[model samples]
Target: MDTTPIAAGTGHAEAAAGGGVRVGALVPLSRPGWVEAGRQLLAGLELGVGDVNRGGGISGRPLELVVRDTAADPAKAAAAVEELAGTGVAAVVGEYHSVVARAAAAQADALGVPFLCSSAVLDALTDEPTEWVARIAPAQSRGWRIFADFLLGAGHRRIAVAAEPSVYWAAGARILREHLAPRGGTLVELDARALGPAALCDELVAQRATALLLLVGTPEPAVPIVTSVRHDPRLADVLIGAPAGQPEFAEWASLLGGDGAAIPFLRYLPEHLSPLGARVEAALRERLDEAASFVAFEGYDTIAVLAEALRAHHGTRTKAADFWPHVTAEGTRGTISFSRQPALTAWQWTWPPIQVADRDPANPTRFRVLHTG
Candidate 1:
């Protein structure tokens, strides 16, 4: 991670008390999956910004957005942040990957530019020496604990967890191990494999695990794992689990011929999972003619927090200090907040229960609530 400072001044005019406000997004448009995520994200932001603009445009100046594709790479992510710095964007919202967002957040903090991460899940992404990297989603560790509590409450003590080798997945695996070990339970096997077709299928069959935890965020990584597992007879009893905010599960359910076609599964939920998600769903329908995924909500919540911060700070150059307060105390995602520490608080993650007897990941056919706390 480059810790070099980025300069945010290209002499772009500051958002005046009654002047135009610009928020930029560094999204990955090349990937079909993330492109949809990004589109929903931009749509959410546009809705928020458009509402603000329509309601008299933030003290009489319209809100505007400048979007740039980061290609979802570290260097390109950094470039996107730097590019926004020169454009006088009051704040930037982007990133679905923790590692990439972590880099971009560091750049935003160095430049004193406020950044709201929409999809990054790694606790360390915002849990370090900077304040600019607040996220709308809960940390990976929090979600891990949630998943652990779910497994324990369901009387499923013997478990096997597998995730991608990415830092985010690794963090979730660690947290799950720590949380599960203390509950009179055991993680019989924990494996992190490469994200490939054969490699995933091999891991699915080779490991002596009951429940599979797919930690990779991208669908490309998750689809193969699920597809491989669906075919393997050994994994038939193993329940597939994913931390919430992954759209791949639902997409997989749909692709596998919908409900009753895939294996049973569970998902962990972040704090503040409210019915308000319907508003987001409706927005996605209008924007993309489809329902928004959990990832889409991450993006939607990100923009909500950024707009609230800008309003709270009265457009004071979009500094992190100015925005963190609003994000913590009052935000649309119901207490969206983060600190510059690597610790996971109980408020951050919760294991909500959803038992899918059918295969539809989007809307599980049959569910019995075990633990929603």
Candidate 2:
């Protein structure tokens, strides 16, 4: 695709031929980030852009993406937003890390640039609600509560969380705790950062926890903890869980093989897909050469929403976020629409489907949906 440079305040009606309506894509493709998740997200976004162009792109010009790697750093993400804003992108989209997305959202809001967050479920995405930003992913509070409910229904009253010290992980642990407290459930926090996987397993055993939730990064504390717990005879009956959807990616199975199975996690996919969703999922699977996670679907939905916003006003680039309240696009998971939700200032999808699922122990690569919300 050609790299088309857009000037700020430019309109599709005023532009000549051969110029692309550029959208900035922020993704973490490098180390220290979840590179697999980032790749899945980019695949969906790229496909969405292709579909947009094929369907008569903004005001007849092709839609282009100006890609930037955030690398899961909040400061780096903010910097990318600044650079994209200066490059005259009509809107900025895509991010996987909650911490980084929060930073990017703040910067985009301050600069008055429209941002469509593809993933990252942090409930407090911004200090205050602004019209400049919106999100496609369900919030952490909402998703985690469903996970808690799943655990309770499965008869796990004593749950333990092996958590790393990070704002995102901390927030998830808090959400789980808050949701479980009133329901006669208990949450035990084991410091994954301080305790090694072996020691973490020991704590789980000592606590008599029926289930262990992983609230840490992959390959580090999460993977090792799963290994230790699965091998320990004392933890034989203890269920392992990842409410942040860690096991949805391929890497988890590659690392733990059969051990990664049955570690239920939160996922944002409906039991059934719309017609558009099924087609996109097939395309995404071909593009990714694997089963695509919900994040990839979010990438497509993000662009779908933004495309409608841009098309609503005959391809007006200025005040792109003004299109948020009006955009209604058919997304992979469901009908995509943004509204001012309660307790949030940013435009929210109000909901996306939520599910609790895990890899099937009988077939490590296959997922078995256990619960839905």
Which candidate wins on TM-score?
A: 2
lDDT of 2 at 131: 82
How well is each residue in 200-300 modelled by candidate 1, as lDDT tens digits? 55655665556766666546566666667766776667776655444333455455444224343333233344566656567666876665455555566
Error of 1 at 69 (Å): 1.6
With candidate 2 superimposed using the best TM-score fit, by how many Å does residue 332's alpha carbon deviate from the native? 1.1
Model 2: how far residue 125 lies from native, Å: 1.2
**Per-prediction TM-score:** 0.77, 0.95
Q: Please give the CA lDDT of all the candidate structures.
A: 0.58, 0.87
Which segments of model 1 are wrong by more than 4 Å? 1-19, 188-207, 217-221, 244-250, 259-280, 326-371
Worst 10 residues of 2 by lDDT: 1-10
Task: State the number of backbone clashes in model 1.
Answer: 2
